[model samples]
Target: MKKLSVSILGTGFVGLCSAVCFAHRGIKVIASTHNEEKANLINQGIAPFYEVELEEILKEVVNRNDGNFKCLVGRKQAILDTDISMIIVGTPMGEDKRIDLTLMEKAAKEIGEVLRMKENYHLTVVRSTVIPGTTRNLVGDTIQKISGKELGKDFGLCMQPEFLAEGRSIKDTFYPDRIVIGEFDKKSGDILQELYESFYGDHLKKAPILRINLESAELVKYGNNCLLATKISYANEFANLAELVPGVDVVQVMKGVGLDYRICERFLGAGVGFGGSCFPKDINAIKAFAQSKGYDPRLLNAVLAINDDQAIHIVDLAENTLNNLSNKKIALLGLAFKPGTDDMRQAPSIRIINELKRRNASNIIGYDPKAKESAREVLGNKIQYANNIEELLKDADCAIITTEWDEFKILKPSKFIRLMKNPFVIDGRRIFSFEEFDKELTFRAIGRVALK
Candidate 1:
């Protein structure tokens, strides 16, 4: 059987991951991006952003797959050259908190223009997450209007949302828990199913495939993220209650709660709350979406509220410990939202740092294994950047562990004692144990009693 030729119409995290994953499965992948610099870097096998194993896989596909994968700057050429085009562009939040589908609409129009000149049948898939009816009503209508092509006759459309976390996107893409295909017609659905089967046949036996309507497919993506966000918020709520009760450990309590089969221990760990690209934006988008349809999303609104409060609580913990933060040299141990990637979108660290500045902290130093450069873009000269963990801790009055990176987890307690003027640590992710630190060191973690 001839392999399918695919074009990914964006070079963000999702588009890059999809391109590499498809190319690894022997499909020819053309990754399209409007940024020439990004395209040049990708062509050289370097990913623009940090994702685990993305660079290595991209190198394998670009250099060793006999030209199976290539990154280009224009969407029209890539669309014309491929049998399938997947729209993975950004859907940033608009002013009204709705998903701004400007990039998605542009990509669809470009694909539509390309399809007008071609005689061969092509499949257009929406891999970006949008509101429920977006795939059919917005993307499909735009493409059809621009190309003069009739849906289910001249071309086919499908909604297949990606369920990838930022840090582990490559693993998630190659081994998704489920594959969803929302088809406009049977022919389009069958073709997409076959393509997925060719790539994920072995995994399908373990992970089920869902064939549903376009709206359901779109809803599935938002539903999954919102539920996970809800779990994190729920745990944080418990953590807040646990603080009032001395000697109560939220971790052990949640562990017992998760032993129940109904609530497994996935996103149950309480920390500085959920922050990243997906949770904050998706929850807001969904809430706005519901309101637009004359519906109220109370639970989702509470989830956002809990998350916002959690970020503020971390700053409260720091201020209470130091007594006065006006001239304190504070050390922030992590910058990225979570470990393993350089993505700092809505990271708890950002809120924590901003609050520290507002409280007149004299010096705020930050360190991240991979996200320092990315953090610089968001934080700029507002805070000090550290070369290493030791440097971040040097002469610091207190330290806060925001991200639970492996490097931060393995640090010896003596390092804190030796470097900091006062070894006061506020652990957001609970990466350390109370008993591990020396008597001179002060340690506090969320959902547990502080140790002095």
Candidate 2:
């Protein structure tokens, strides 16, 4: 049997991870990018974004391929010559809350032009988060119109949505709960399934591959993200309730809720709502899609509203605690949204800093191991960037942990408490306990009892 050729467009998070995952399973990957600089980064075994295991995986694939199936910049001859091309380009949200499919549209046109220059039957799979009917409308129809080829006869079409977390992208790709494929027909489904033949079988024996219509697959991506967003909002709502009630902690409430079989305890922590590439974008897309279909989407709108409030709750606490915040040096422990990756797209840190700046809060200092550069870009001139934890907390009036980077978890309280001018720490992520801190420092944690 001849090996199937695969090309992944867009060198961003989704594209890079997908390329390496396929290559790890022995598929020939032509990871395509428009810029020569990004392509050079990939060729040199460096991932464009900060993912935990992506560098290792990318380097392994490139070394194994011996430069044959490596990252290629531009619409190179090799990418156009490949048998299968997957579109993982970004589809950003426009001002109107609709998905901006311009990137995907341009990539599809290029792929179609490549198809026009070829005779073999080619299959194009879209893995980006797009609105329903995008593959059929934006990609499939565009390719058909451009290449002058009949759909499902001269060529094939499918949508395979990617489910990857920012930091845990590598593991999530290969070991996903299940792989869903929306194909035009069973033949198209089978051919696409063959690409993942190596990864599936043993662990997911029963229903490793799920077959659905193209729109269903697109809907599945949105549905999953919306549900996750709901979980965060639900937890935050409970945390607000807990705050109002005396002696009730949302941490205990979540612990009780998680003990139930249905809840299972993920995204239940009530600190500053979710911020990253997936949750915000996906939830907004769901709202836009729902509104377009004539639905009110009130529930999703509330979810976002609650999240916005959640982001500011910490700053509110800080302001309420200190009467005047000007000229007071405040320390922020984490910057990335949930850590592990250097992506700070919608990080709650941005919200907290902006709010603080508005109220003329003291000097805001931030320190994060991985997300300093990205955070710096978002927080330019608004705050000072600290080199280390000690520097961040030096003579600080209060400390807040927005992102739960693991390194912050193990820091000795004795060390943190000693450096502060006034020992008031807001455990926004519920990272520390009373046992860690002395009686002098007042600890204010989310959904937990405060100790002075």
The root-mean-square deviation over C-alpha atoms between each candidate and the true structure, in angstroms, is: 1.2, 1.7
Give TM per candidate.
Answer: 0.98, 0.96
Where model 2 places Cα greater than 4 Å from the true spot, the runs are 65-68, 76-78, 199-201, 434-440, 449-452
lDDT of 1 by residue, 97-212 (tens): 78899998899889889988988899999999999989898889988998998889988999998898888999998899999898988888898998888989899997788999
Q: Following a full C-alpha superposition, what root-mean-square deviation does model 1 have from the true structure?
A: 1.2
Q: How far is 416's C-alpha from truth in model 2 (Å)?
A: 2.1
Q: lDDT score, residue 175, model 2?
A: 84
Q: Tell me the lDDT of candidate 2.
A: 0.83
